[model samples]
Target: MSDDRFEVVIVGAGPAGAAAALALAREGVEVLVLERGDFPGAKNLFGGILYTSVVNELIPEFWENAPIERHIVNRRWLTLDEDTQIGLDLKSAKFDVPPFNNTFTALRSKWDRWFAEQAEEAGAMVICETNVEELIVEGGTVKGVRTGRDDGDVEADVVILAEGANAMLAERAGFRPQMGPRNRVNAVKEVIALPPEIIEDRFHLEGRQGMALEYFGGAVKGTVGSGFIYTNHDSLSVGVGCLIEEYLRLNMAPYDMLDEFKAHPMIAPLLRGGETVEYATKMIPEDSYDSLSDLYEDGLLLIGDCAGLVNPSIHHEGTNLAMASGVAAAEAVLSARKSNDFSKARLAEYRERLEDSWVMKDLKRYRDTVHFLLENREMVNEYPDLAIRLIRRYFTLDDTPKDDVIKELWKTIRSEVNFLKAARQMWRARKTML
Candidate 1:
């Protein structure tokens, strides 16, 4: 093997690439991880939760040393109306203890760096500021990567693409179809800083406990989008995201929606005296399992968002899926390497492993969720309004009688909601998610 050739080459140092590098390095494989940013996390703009199961397995008790912001012990799912909001708030003592299995909030800038460091510690070569221009294919078989450098054509026995939602390299290589606005979401986020005590008091948090608030309905100004606020140690990660097609169709400004959401009657006071510290934008592939591209060919494998591994379920799970795919890819490569085989047929094991893992199973389970939501935008736009109206009237003292209010509410629902549509959606949700 030449000096520049490696057993495996992983593009993008996000969770998937880093995880693969770590696992492969531990197996003493010659793996190289390339990042286009100045550092692993420098270009990442995620402001969401990370489920720790996959990562925790990679690094036991990772929370002890990781750059985690907060351990979420409280969850709030809100539906905002014009002047009112309704939602569920559940706090669990079960999630407050060690491991914090529920989830935790983190800034990708710091978290990704730490994760990549783990890979480096395990003997993986992670190079930053290296742009992998294209995959080096020879006679319809994947071989290596061509980077933007004088001596940049680095050969590898196998290449794992973890290039994220844009997946330009994968698209250019014909490994996957170009992602469309219909299946993508443009999210804008801001990290608003406040005193730790103030944040604690505001979000009803105690100690290192945190809250995650997810908003629907008017939060996106009646658009097919959603908003979120996750408590950090001393900052709040607040953002709104909507389908790219909806954004373009409505000529909606994501930042403008964020502003309106911040000014919400219930949300504004929580950030009354906070200062915005960081702002970022990211494109998330929300299309479920059906939209996933081809998983493997020749010596190439696609994992994470580049492979459409994001679960578009209400959970919005991406990180865990990414890590799982990474680990699975590493295992497949190790198995293939044992036989000194690097063929498309051999690499196909990666797909089988992913399907056998929760990554594909969970995604397949929620395959119809994004489609159902797109077909029924009213669930995010009008239904929340209807719900708030009904609940408000029911609680109002001006109600003449309880039974009368119930009858009136039923009449309002019958007039405004398409029962057939509602029934169909309910059935679809039951069949797909339940």
Candidate 2:
């Protein structure tokens, strides 16, 4: 290969790009990965959970050597009101063992760089701080990419677009349509430093075990979003995110929501006395599978957020899907290489691989969830408060008879909500989300 050419070029060095580079490089494919950040993960942010099943496939027993902070053995889901919360917490000792249930908490800034290094060590040429200006397209075929550097036009047999949610290059190249606000989520996060002992005590964790907590309803001021807090070794990743369209429609700011989340009565005590060590913001693609953009074209494939691979359901999965898409992209490229074919038909294998994997299956399963929640805002906005009120009333030590309390609760429910409509909504929720 020449200095200005490679067999495959990947834009963005996040999990997807790095995974693809590593896989292709391991197979002796000449892959080049370009990253716009000062280094990989410098500009990436997530809720702190790294689902490592895909990583384990790439590097068996990755948790043994990766810069993993903690293995999550406890998961909690909470519904919040102004000053009250109802929660369900699940803990499993099995998750604390070897595979750790494939869930771990990691700081992206540290993890991304480490992952890219693995790709580099495997023979992929990773160039950081080099922004891909655009794709070099000729006769509707992607030839390579043009970067911001001198002699920037580097040619490649195929180009993989893993450029995060913004997908500027993909948009510019018309590989996908410009994503609207409703199809995206804006999030802000803070890494709050605390004593390790305090973290363990407060979260009921032992050793390197961690807990992941997700909040809905008042968490984002009843917006179509959620808040998350993940326990790290000596810090907490706290953040809130909602639909970009919700942010605009409600005239709200992500930072303000994050502040509110941190200040919530139930949330504040956990983060008390902690110092903020890092703050970052990110955009996530929440597009439904039915609305997903074209995955492949001649000489090109889009993976990760750029391809809208996010599963925006209760699962809250993104990184794992991104890495899986990366591996699939690499497989497709390798297949095409065997025939020296870089046409759209040859690259269709990328989509087929993803369709055959859990990545696409989960996305398809919850394709209607985001839209359903958006349309039925009452499920998130009103139901949590109502449930909390009823539960609080039930647990209150009042002089009234228990039967009277149950009757009163039923009366309140009848007065406040239409039973038929509520039942219908619940059925729809089950169909859309379950």
Candidate 3:
């Protein structure tokens, strides 16, 4: 064996890659993690919401020393209709207790680097600023990767691809195909600085406590997109994500939609007097299980955004899936190393593990759901409008028969959205979600 080569080589030192590297290193395996950015997460962005379960699996009680913005205590989901908002609120005083199992806001630029350091400390060698160009192949059996340097053809028994959204290497190797318009979304985000006290007052929270507000409807220029505003210690992460198909049809720059969302009457006040500190944009794969491409080959495993693992239907839960897949890949590699077998048949265990776990099971459950929602265009536009109109009518003070109110509701719903269509959507949602 060459002195420089290792048993496993992981590309992209973000959550999945770092998690995989750390886990493999902890198991006493030789792992190498490579990052293209100047550092592990210099090119990464943050919505700042991270689940503790994912991190705790690798580093139990991670918040003990990690740079966490705040342990979240409040959550609000909002549907906006012009100037009005319909809200669902959930808050628990118990969340402030130990183990804080939910989540906290974070900056990836700092967190990813820290995670990479953890991997390094666990005995994985992480080299930064080295971009892997393509996978080195031999007679259709996966072997290793070729980077962009003179001695760049680094060989390994196994290669784990955790490259974020582009996944160019994965597409090139035919492990997965390129995403269609429906499978992709363009997300634009900004980190704006505000006083910590102002953030507390505007979001109606006590000292040092943070709140998350997700906005729909009025912010997207009536498009099939939503706005998100999540609080940090003294900064707010605000952004919008729209399907690539919708973005092209509207011929609008993402930044324009970002501006519209900020200027929204409901949003503008919270953001008032705040200064935009940084801006970033990235592609997120939101096509659910139907978009599941190849996950395994002879000597390679794909994890994280490279495999298109974003569940936008929920809280954009890709990182957790990434970590889980990383763990599965590491386990498969460890088993194969034990048996000295790197055949495709042996590597199929990773896929089986994925299916048996929540990552693949939940994704496959919602595989057709994205298409279901996209097919029903009115749900994003007309349906929400109908709901707001019904609420407005119920509160109107004009003298009218009480039974007439029911008739008015029916008339409005039928005129704005066909009853048959609405009923079909409800049925489809129930089936698809289940």
Tell me, by lDDT, which candidate is best. 2
Ordered by TM-score, highest first, the candidates read 2, 1, 3
Residues 1-434, candidate 1, lDDT per residue (tens digit)? 13499999999999999999999999999999999999998988765798879998899999999999899999988998768889898899999997886499988889999999999999999999999999999999888999998789889999999998888988888888778888888999999999999999988889889899999888887766689999988899999988888888888788888898998898898888999998889999887677677688999999888888887766878888888999999999999999989898998899999888888788888888777777877767777789899999999897388999899999999999899988887788786755
What is the per-residue lDDT of model 2 for residues 222-336, given as tens digits with 9 covering 90 to 100? Answer: 8889999999889999999899999999887889899989999999999999999899988989999998876999999999999999989988889999999999999999999
Worst 10 residues of 2 by lDDT: 1-10
Model 1: lDDT to the true structure: 0.88
TM-score of candidate 2 versus the correct structure, residues matched by position? 0.98
Q: Candidate 2 at 325: error in angstroms?
A: 0.2
The residue ranges of model 2 lying beyond 4 angstroms of the native Cα positions read 1-3
Off by over 4 Å in 3: 1-3, 396-407
Cα-based TM-score, every candidate: 0.97, 0.98, 0.95
Better of 1 and 2 by TM-score: 2
Q: Model 3, 298-417: lDDT tens per residue?
A: 888989899877666746677778888888888888898999888888888888888899888778777876687678766667666667778878877788886899799988777776
Residue pairs of candidate 3 with colliding backbone atoms: none
